[model samples]
Target chain A: MPLLKTENVTHFFGGLKAVSDFNLRIEPGELVGLIGPNGAGKTTVFNLVTGAYRATEGRIIFDDQDIVGLPPHQINKMGISRTFQTIRLWNEMTVLDNIKVAQHGHIQYDLKDIFLQLPRYRNQEQAIEAQAMKMLKLFNLADHAQQPARNLPYGQQRRVEIVRALAANPKLLLLDEPAAGMNPQEIEELMVFIQRIRSELGVTIWLIEHQMRLVMNICERITVLDFGETIAEGGPDDIQRNTKVIEAYLGVEDEEIS
Target chain B: MAGRSGNLFSSIFRPVGRIVSPVWTALRRQLAQTPVLAFQLGVLVAVLLEQWQGEAFADLLGFRRIPRFFGIVDIFEPFSDLDFSGILAPFFPSPNNISASPLQDSVQALGELATTFVKAFFYQGPRAPGFFDVTFRVLIYDIVVFVVPILIIAFLLRPLVSELLRRFPKWSLILVHLIILAAIVLLWGDDGGTRELVLIFMGINIILTVSLNLVNGYMGEFSVGHAAFMAVGAYVSSVMTMWAFVDDRVFGAPALDPSWGLPVGFAIALFAGGIAAAIAALLVAFPSFRTRGDYLAIVTLAVNFIVQSAINNMEGIGGARGLNGVPLWSDLSWVLLTTILSVFIIHSLVNSTFGKGIIAIREDEIASELMGVNTKRIKLVTFLVSSFFAGVAGGLFAHVLAYINPGNFGILKSTEVLVMVYLGGMGSISGSIIAAIIFTLLLEALRPLAILKWVVIPLILIVLMLFRPQGLFGFREIELNWGWQKAKEKPEVSGATAED
Candidate 1:
C-alpha cells in the first residue's frame, strides 16, 4: 500500500502558483527525492503535506487516513514527521531537551506527575531521556547532548533536526533541503546516516535536495518540478538524461562544469 | 565597654564554633549537601519555629494574637472600623456664613464663591454624598442580608472539605498551606489602623494579582489592562446590585426587600460583575485575534480607558462620581477566603490539560499550534476565565469600598496589579501568592515611609528583575497537599550516581 500520497494538491500565492496539481505516491519503506530550481514548489509541497499551510486544492492521505486541513501536530501524531528546510530547532533548549519536547506527544506524564514528581513521571522522564541520548549517539551527537542546538555548527543543527523528527518514531519522514549548506564530507556522512536510518528503522523518506550530485547519489527515484508543475518522475539515470529535468536544473541549457 | 563585652563573647563563641570544627564541618557539610527531601523537612521545621516565635514576640509586645484570639487589640480590628470622617475634614473647607457687617459679608461672599468653584471642579467635598452613604444604602437591600448567612454556611462547610482532603493521602500537604496563609495574614494585619475601604482595596489587589498570574504567568501573556476588566466587573455588579436594592429600569423591579437590601444587593452584584467582565473580554478577544504580543497589551490598556471613559460619560450611573449603593460584601473572612480560592483554582488550572495547553502556548505558540492546539481558542478561553476571576475580585472590591469611581480603575491601578505580578514572577503560581502577601505587607509595613516607600519599591523590583526575572518559583506551583501524603520511606536508587 502507498504510505504517503498527495492527490492534485495545489497551492497558490496570488499571481504565482507555487504548487499546482502536484501528486506523488511512495510505498512503505521507499526512499524518494524531490528536486527543482530555487523557486520550484518542493518545500511548498512539504508544507502542504505537514499542514503548515492549507493547500489551495486537493487532498493528502497518509496510511489510508485523509490528512488534508489537519494541523501539523495531528499529522505528526498520525505517524508522519518532518524536518525544516532551514532547520527550525528549538534554539534555546539543550539538544536532548529539543528531542524530549518532540517526544511530548508520546510521553504520558501529566501536570500532576510533573509538579509532584510522581513515580510514573520520574520513570517516564528517565526513559525519554535515555531514548533521547540514544538517538543522539546514533548521529555521533551524544557528546553534544547538553549543548544548546544554536551553538552547534549548521551541519550538526541539521542532524539535530533529523534526530528530533525521529524521536517521534514516525513511519514517514520528510526532509526539506537536508543538504542545503553541507561540505562534501558532511554530505557523504549524512548520506550514510540516512541509509542506516532507513535500513534499521524501516521508515520511508521523502527528501528535497538542491545539490544534484547528492540527489543523484542517494535518491532511488526522483520527481522533478518547474513552476508548480511536475515535469518528470523516474529513476536517477532516467532523470539525469530527461530533457525537461536537465532544462529545469540548468536554466534551459546545460552549462558544462570546467 | 559594651562593644568589648560583645567582642569577648563572639571571640569565646568563635573557638566553640571551631573546636567542634570536624563535627560542625560534618554538620555544615551535611546540611549543605542534604538531599531535597531532608532539606524540605528542615525548611518545614524552620518555618514552624519562625511562626511560633513571631506569635510569641507579638504577644509579648502586646500585639494582637492569632488562632482564635479575637481580642480588641487584634491587628485587623482597626482596619475594619469603617470610618474615614477624620481625614476628609482638612481638604474640605466650610463656607463662612456670618460676618460683622453687610459690606464685610459681601467681601466674604466673593471669597466663598471662589472656594466653592475650586471645590466643585477639583475636590470631593466632605459633606458631599460619597462611598459611605452608598454602602449604607446597598446594605439595606435583601441581597446584602443574604450574603453573611451564605458565607457563614460556606465557612462552616470548609473544614469538612479539608477533612476529606486530609483523608486522601494525596492532599495532606494542602494543610501546610492553610497554616502558611494564616500565618502570613495574621502577621501582616494592620495594627496602626487603615480605612476599611483601603483594606478592601488591598484585598482586591491580592485577588487581581493572583488571578491575573494564571493568564500572564502560566498561560504566558502580558496583560496591561487587568484593572480595566475589574472596572467592567465593578460596574456590572454595582449596577445590578443597585437595581435589586432599589427600583431601576435595568431590573424592572426591586429584587430584594429594602430591609435586607445589602445582602441581596451583594449577591446580585457578584453575578452582574462576572457578566460584565465576560462582555469586556469579548471586546478584548477581537483585537487579540490579529494582534499579539505588545499589541495585545496595548489593546487591553485601551480597553481600560474605554470602559472608564464610557462610565464617565454615562450620566445615569453618576457619570464620574460612579454608581453607588454597593453593599459592603467583603469582610476579612470574605477577602481571605476568596484569595485562597482564587489561588487554588488557578493552581489547579495550571496542572490540568487546559493548564498544560496554556503552558505549552507560553513555551512556543507555533509549536503548540502545530501540535494541534487551537491557539486562538485557548487564548480566548484563558482571557475570559481570567476576566471572570477579575470580576469576582471587582465585586468584592466594590462592596468592600462601599463606593467606587471611574478614577479607581485607571492606569495607576493596572500598574499596581502589574507590580504585584512582576514582583511575584511572571509564571510562578506560588511566587504570585508570596508576592501578593509580601507586597501587601510591604505596603503596610512601609506606610510610615510614605512617598519614600515607592522609590524603595522600584529599587527592590529592579534588583529582583535583574537577578531573578523568572520569578521566585518560575512556573512551579504552591501545592498544598493537605491530607494527601505518602509513606515517609525514601525510595533507594541502587545504581544511579549522585547528580552532583
Candidate 2:
C-alpha cells in the first residue's frame, strides 16, 4: 500500500481555486517531485496535504486515516512533516533547540511534569536532545549545534530546516522549493542531501522545485502542476520531453496584451 | 582618613580572604544547590553557638543584633556594654611594642589581625535594612510564606532552568527576595506610610509588566490593551468582595461574615477575577487566529473598551460612579505574595518546553505549526495565562485603592502597562522588574507633572524606540551575583545514537 494517497483533493482561497482536484500517491521510501511555475499551486498542494490549509473537498488518507480536515499539527503528528518554501527557522533559538522543538508531538510529559521536572520529563528531554544531536552529527552540523539558526549561512539554514523536519520522525517528508534561491553548488549538495535522507532514514520524499536541473537529476517520478491543475505526471525523462510541461514553464504565446 | 582606611582594609583582607576562600566557595555552592538544607544547618549552627557562647558572642557575629526588624533588642544586642577595644588590644599593632625582627613582627601582626577579623563577621550597630536582617523571625515568616516555597519550587525546576541566565543567581536570589520581603515587612510595620504605598505599587506594577511581557515580550505579540484584563480582575474581585463579603452600599449587606472575608474572600475573589479576565481574554484570543500586529492590537484595544463599557453598564456594581467599599484588603504582603507568584509562574512557564512553544509561535507561527506545535491551542493558552495574571494585578489594585471605575481600566491604564513592558525591555523577567520599579518611581516623581507625565513618558518611549527598541532588558536577563557563580556548567554530551 502507498504510504500517502490523496484522492481528488481540492482547495480554494475565496474565489481563487488554489489546488483543483489534486491527486497523488507515494510509495514507502520513494522519491517524488512536484514542479510548477510561480502561480502553479505547488505550495498549496503541500499545504493541503500537511493540513496547513484543509482541502475543501476530497480525502487525504495517510497511514489509512482520512486527514483532510485535521489541523496542521495533528497531521504533522500523524507522520507528515514539511519544510516551508522560505527557510523559517526560529532565528533566536539555538540550532539544537530548533531541532528539539520539532519533536513537540513526540514529547510525552505533561505541563505538570515539566513544571516539577519529574523523572519522566527528564528522561524524555534527554532523549529528544540526544536525537537532535544525533541528527546534527549525521548532517555534520554538530559543530554549530549551539549557534542560533539565523547565524548560519542560507544554504545551511535550508539544511537545518530539513534536519528540523526530520527530527519529528515523519513517515513522509514534504519539501517546498528547498532549492529556492540556492546557488548551483548548493543545489547540487541539496540533491545529494535529499537522496541521502531518503536512502538512510527510509522516509518517502515529495518536493516542489523551480530548479529543473536538480529535479530532472534526482526525482524518480515527477508531477507537474500549472494554474491549480496537474498538467503532467510521469518519469523525469518523460516530463523533460513533455511539450505541455515545457509550455507551462515558459508560459503560452499571448495574441495581445491583456 | 577614607583613603587610609580603604588601603588598610585591602591590605588586611588580602591574605585573610585567601585563607577562607575555599570554605566560602564550598558554603556558597551548598547555598546554591540546597538552600533549604543550608537554612536548616544554619539554624542548627546558630542554636549551637548560642549554647556554646553567650548572647554577646552571637551579637558580634551579627545575627542577634544589627538591623533588627521586630524592634526587640536581643540579649546579644551589639550596642550593649560590650567593650570591643578590650577584646581587640592584642590585635592592635602598638607602635611602642615594635620588637624583634620585622618579618616576625609582620607575621604576628597578620595573625592577630586575622583573629580580630574572624571576631567580627558583620558590622555591629543599629542601621537600615541590610545584611543580618535575614536572621529575624519576620524573615522566617517571609521565607516560610514566600521565599522558601519559591526556593523549593526553584529547586524542583533547577534542571530545566539550570540553563541560561537563570542558573547564575541560584543562591543569591533567595537573599534578594528575602531582602525585598523583609524590607516590605519592615516598611509596612513602620508608621512611615508613603514608602509603604510605593512598595505596594511597585509590587503591583511588577505583576503588570511581567504578566503582559508574556504576550508582548516572549510571544512577540502586540497586546495594546492589557489593562482591560486587569480591570476584569479588579471588578470581579471587587464585586466578589463587595457583594458577598463586605457590607457595601451597592450590595447592601455582607452575605458572608466580614471577619473571615478579609482572609478567605480576597484569595477566592482574586482567583475568580483572574478567571473572568482569562475568559474575557478569549475575546481577543479568537481574533488572534486571523489578526496580528496592528490588527490584532486593535482587537486587544477593542476588548479593553468593551470590558470598561461592560463594567460601566452594570448598574448594581456602581455603574459610572465606580466600585466602592472593596474592603481594602490588598496590603503589602498580598501584593508581594501575588507578585512573586506571578513572577514564579511566568518564569516556570517560559522556562519549560511548553513555554518554548510559545516562543516558537512568536518566532514563526506557521513554521511552529508545521513542526507539530499546536498553534491554535498554544495561542489560546497563552492568551488565557497572560490575561489571568493581568486580572490578578487588577484585583490587587482594586483592593489597595478600595475603589475602581471603568475609567480606571481604560486605554490610559493599558498605556501605563505597555510603557513598563517596553521600558523594562521585552522578554526579560529581571528587566520587567527593574522597569516596573523605575517606572513606578518616575510616575510618583512626575505626579506633580500631572498630564505632562504622559508627554514625558512618550518622550522616553521615543528615545527608547530610536535607540533600544528592545527595552532596557530586552531578550536578556540580569544575573544576580554573577561574579559569585563564575563556574561554567558542562553541557551533557550524549553519544550519537545508531539510526533505526
Tens digit of lDDT per residue, candidate 1, span B1-500? Answer: 12235878867776776677778677555444332322333334434443456456444433344311212112222222222332333344456633335555555555665554344333334433233332333343212223333333334444564465455554444555566455445444423235343455566777788778877776668788888889888878777776666665434567767666555556556767877897788888877756557877888888889988998998887789776656656776566766776666666555444355676677667765554345676688778878877988888887777788899899888888888888887777677767876776676654534455677678888998898887676655554332334442112223432210
Score candidate 2 by TM-score against the native: 0.72
TM-score of each: 0.64, 0.72
Off by over 4 Å in 2: A11-21, A108-126, A226-228, A237-258, B1-192, B447-455, B480-500
For B77-97, candidate 2 gives per-residue lDDT tens digits of 322322333333444547896
Give the per-residue lDDT of model 1 (tens digit) for A126-150.
6776777777766677767767678
Off by over 4 Å in 1: A1-3, A57-80, A90-171, A179-203, A210-218, A240-258, B1-168, B183-203, B213-221, B238-276, B313-319, B351-356, B359-364, B449-500
Give DockQ per model, in order.
Answer: 0.15, 0.30
For candidate 2, give the docking quality class from DockQ: acceptable
Residue clash pairs of candidate 2: B425-B471
Each prediction's RMSD over C-alphas, in Å, is 12.8, 15.4
Ten-residue region with minimum lDDT total, candidate 2 chain B? B67-76
Write down the lDDT of every candidate, Cα atoms only: 0.69, 0.77
